[model samples]
Target chain A: MNLLRTAREMLEGTSYTLGIAGRTALALPQLWRRRRETTEQCYAASVKLIHVIVLVGAFAGMILSLQTGLALADFGQEGSIGSIVAAAMVREMGPFITAVILAAAVGSALAAELGTMKVSDEITALEVMSIDPVPFLVLPRVVALTIACPLLAIVANVVGIYGGSIVAESLLRVDPLAYRETVYDVLARPAELFPFPKDIYAGLFKATVYGFLIAVIGCSHGLRASNGALGVGEAARTAVRNSIILVLVMNFILTRVMYT
Target chain B: MSTAASDAGAAVRFESVEKQLGGKQILRGLSFEVPRGTSFVIMGPSGSGKSVTLKHIVGILAPDAGRVLVFGREPGQLSRSELASLRSRIGLLFQDGALINWMNLEDNVALPLREVQRLPEREVRPRVAEALERVHLADAAQKMPSEISGGMRKRAALARAIVSRPELLLYDEPDAGLDPATGGSINRLIRRVQRELGATGVIVTHSRSCALTVGDRIGIFEQGRMASEGTAEEMATSSDPRVRIYLGIDGEATTERSDSRGAEHGTGATGR
Candidate 1:
């Protein structure tokens, strides 16, 4: 009987602008704090993630050069290889690759740590102490990831450009100087290189939002998780799955809006 | 004794509280008073709403139909800073210890003092060391929560809770998972801390020993209200069958005892 009434109250709560405003008011500080904490955790989590990005970038650059070199060679347009690879990497590949890396690396960790805390009642302990877990746990990671994602995007660009250069010089037998000039010419336009920063910044913004979303969802779900190891596992899986989907959806929406 | 007077000027009150969740009335028109220096035990059967009662004291759950006061101000009436100030005076010992796995024992214990108190870095170490010593876990300060035993984790939690020298200590089933001997020791710690620090203690526990040892007064919760209230001796000798059953002692006459505690929530034995 009381549950029905409580549900009704919650429903009525959804009907009011004041209720929505109050909910937002209460949630904003928590969201801000969550962003800050997630940023901190993201720093530690991103170290290994950066290593993976480097390894993948190096190999990915090598593979792109090989395929593009072969294709251009067949068309007797081998010298156009550096420009083609540079356009693809700077325009799209760099940010896309970094986003995917963070979703797997830092996203998973946020889920697992928050899940463990939730199952173990650490989050409850915070509530009892009147500490906002959002600031203490979530915000650091958000801030850290926000900063780290852009830095990683920059790193991917450097490695990818170098990979394209290597393919142009070695696989196509083009001179290193010629390949460098072609790459520069292709990237010389402000539209090409200018968009890089926007893309990188947007990628970082997405990552920050992504980190915050994952941490909040993870912590919220975990804190509400049923008691047991299974609950923790479920929370982690859910956080990762949800974050990946959100990241992709956000990336699609944001890229179109920014570029268009 | 000195700080006790200061906190009396800052006591928390709850008036005619009622709370319902999911069609179930967890707390129904419950009212209570907690003064500055007395340890108050909230005793009840599994679903009698003891845990919900504690949540109200901390402002985690706003009462659906009544008022809850901390430092003479309603939790909702106070500004965020004022509420935080009130909260800083109260220390909570969670049932599962709730130690942060990413933090070492020392850092976990030192967290509030650093974040809320904002003590200098040099000053934090000694305060952390002293707090850990109070719980007899000074040497284990560098260990992770997983590295410690369940009992040690509880001790770490105690260290963290008391590190800031809070004026009020709240325990949610402080003795839930321990053996009888260990639970007794925990009870003694509760009493010892309350006595030494002169802090008001509110403990929710089914453990009779814990209540007897630590609480100066006991309040029995039943059917979502304060069913009965008395001293431990009065309760033990009362004619109330519910009180007798709560004491875990069988009585000699025709006493009506409801077995509702075991019916739902599995005795809430270890507490959520």
Candidate 2:
């Protein structure tokens, strides 16, 4: 019952603050005095994106190579390996892997930092000063997350494809030229890779939606945290749990609409 | 800052106000007027709804019943812009100071002006400097809240409170956690500001010296009501047990004196 009540309150708070954030976005020019290219913000976001892309991309690729090799060997067509790996990474694994990485890394950080600020009365101080914190704090994060995540997925796709290529050549004794040719041929097909413009669009849309969800949960939980150390930990934990769940749920819905 | 002190009007007024939290009543039918150009202290022990009353003035908490009028307009009913205007006109000093630890003292104090007004750097810089000077914290303007002493942070928070030169001021335990000397200085500064700017104040404090120095007419909170009110002089002289106890006077000594005086006068006027 207590958990249910807390969830209800968190939802209410998120919606209320999001409405305020919407209004504040309209008044951005004044609040953001130094809108002259936020290089530091973009740099920080890029570092987070790169870290996830590299780790998830390499791991997914190695698993795909090993498993696909064994499975395809039974069918007597292990030569289809490169095409299989390339297609899977671009269409399915890339977006899903990227979202999960963000949910754990960047999303959790947002919750922890904003949560600490909230518990420390920073949000209240901003309100007292007539500075609406929703826009000042949440908007930049949402924008950064949305723009960075999709780009990171593209990078993950390429890196994962390379990882599979390495295994095919080094471990599986497949000719590098043949593997490259198969990957290129499979990826070149518009239908297999793109499917529909809606597929790519849906992935991007999901990224943005995930961004919105993460920021909302992080900020709301942070702002309403209890007054000390334990409060900060709770906010971070709640943000990560809620954001990861919401991301997977959203991805499932988007996938159904795009593929099924 | 100088121009804001020029306007003269009733700073804040509460008419039959009521507040409830979690289905429990915090304030019940509170009605009062705080005239401009003086300080009025709300005296009460803990859990007396003092902070709730202050929040209503800033629209942080809305009264469930009755009207809250600030500068003659209902605070709850005001449009966002209007509410913003009213808030900018009134300065609130929270009990915890509510300083933004991320920002240095200058930025924290400059936050309101930067948000509410589109003033140039030249204009805002002087005001920030002047505000810091008023709180005797001009030296610590560039220091973060973490780097400053507790007393200095409180002073910095006070500087933030007054940066906009508000016509009305609210202090939520301004002397809380300060040493006797620092607390006394805070009281004197509050009194001095009340005189110089002629800003009406609602000070919520536990300090006896704070109430006596800052409040022209003090209200003693009790039994879900303002049980009694009078000038400091009248309250100091009152034989009421609640008043006597709060004032730290000998309860038995006052009771005996009142009894003897009542017997000598052959009346019950002083007996109660």
Candidate 3:
């Protein structure tokens, strides 16, 4: 019984969250009008998060490079470690870390802030003023995250790939020049539909999707909060948990669709 | 059976409106009318659905049955734009101020004008300044909500509510958490706004001072319905035992458990 109830609530929450996004799309014209607020949110989403992205990205690349190099070294193919690390970071880890950091850090804060506003009657106050919260509050946040996610993912890819190359050269005894040449060769592989390689474009696309999902989930949870402080706390927690789940699910689905 | 509209005619009319929230009936066949250009006070014990009624007037919450009419049109029947138009003509002061914490006092007050009125920036500033001056918060214009005192926050919210010069003003427990002096200042500001704007005011409050000082007609609510209504004089001299008991004028309920917190909208508060 409890499981069924929880499932029903999850479905309802997802439906409402998407409903908010749909409404936000209808209010897109207002985005240009409210560009100042959107720009501020973009700065907030990116600048506050750059440090975490760099730290996570660097560690992710270093680990992948070290593991791949040690295994390949047994076969006397350690020179190929740099290429594998580049492929993994560009196709997966870079976007993954970006999405995780955004969901855990920024999404939670958005949810908590909005949840506090809802419980305290500030949201109702906006409605009373004939101001739709969708246009005024949700749109800027969604736009900012959607735009920030891809750009930040690119930064992660660069830093992570560089970290991996360093690990390959120093830890695995692969020649530094050879490692760099192989990494470049992998990225230089012919592309079909985009300027960048399929892996690079696909990962950025995934990050963008994750960013949009995080903002919608966060805003929806916040708007639904009631009962006060405990409710606000729950909203923030749910935003992070649900965003990460959705990101992983989307990542798998996108990987299967694009690569296959 | 009782009516609460001022003698001038109904600006807002609730005809046997029934609303259920969280599986509990919060407003049970409730009915009342509020006339234009007068201060009407809805005084009730906590959880008596006073604030809910205020929300209904602005179309924030719709009744489950019956009708809620503002300006002879049902708020529930209006289109989104129409409802917004109606809401634009009204201003609401929330119980805890509800000022957006991110914005400074000036921006907060300027919201109605900037967002609703869509006025130019030049037009918004002077009106905001004027509203702040009225509430005696002119010096705190640049301060964020977190930087201000609770009383100042309430005053700033009031300024925001009136900056648009709305035709109808609603107050929900306008002095909920304030010192006596601050509450008194708020009460005085509320009266001044009503007198100066000639706007219809529906104030939902438990403060005896608020009801008596500002109300032209005072209605007492009991369990989602109006128990009685009259001038402050009539409320004080009321003959109905229920009215006297509720007003605590007759000292009847002091004998009971003393803490009869009525049902909350959700926390199992139901109409008797």
Q: Between candidates 1 and 3, which one is better according to lDDT?
A: 3
Q: What is the lDDT of candidate 2?
A: 0.73
List the candidates' TM-scores in order.
0.79, 0.84, 0.92
How high a TM-score does candidate 2 get?
0.84
Q: Write the per-residue lDDT of candidate 1 for residues A1-260, one digit (tens) a residue.
A: 99999899545533432332334335555564355455456567567677788877766776777788888888887787777767666656666677667766766666677768877778877766666665566556545665676677667777987977776777678777877777777776544445544434544555555544444444444444565788777766765676667667877787787678
lDDT of 3 by residue, A44-83 (tens): 9998889889888988999999998899989999988878
Off by over 4 Å in 3: B1-8, B239-241, B245-272
Candidate 2 regions with alpha-carbon error over 4 angstroms: A1-42, A191-205, A224-232, B1-9, B236-238, B247-272
**Span of ten consecutive residues with least summed lDDT in model 1 chain B:** B253-262
For residues B1-272, write the lDDT of model 3, one tens digit per residue.
01233324578889999999989889988988888888889987888899889989999889999999887767787888988878888889898899998999999999989898899998988999999887777888999999877778888888999999988899998877777556756776677778788989999987766676577788988889988888766776688876676556633323221221221112111100
Query: Model 1 misses residue B150 by how many Å?
Result: 1.4
Q: Report the alpha-carbon TM-score of model 1 versus the true structure.
A: 0.79
DockQ of each: 0.58, 0.41, 0.78
Each prediction's whole-model lDDT (CA) = 0.71, 0.73, 0.85
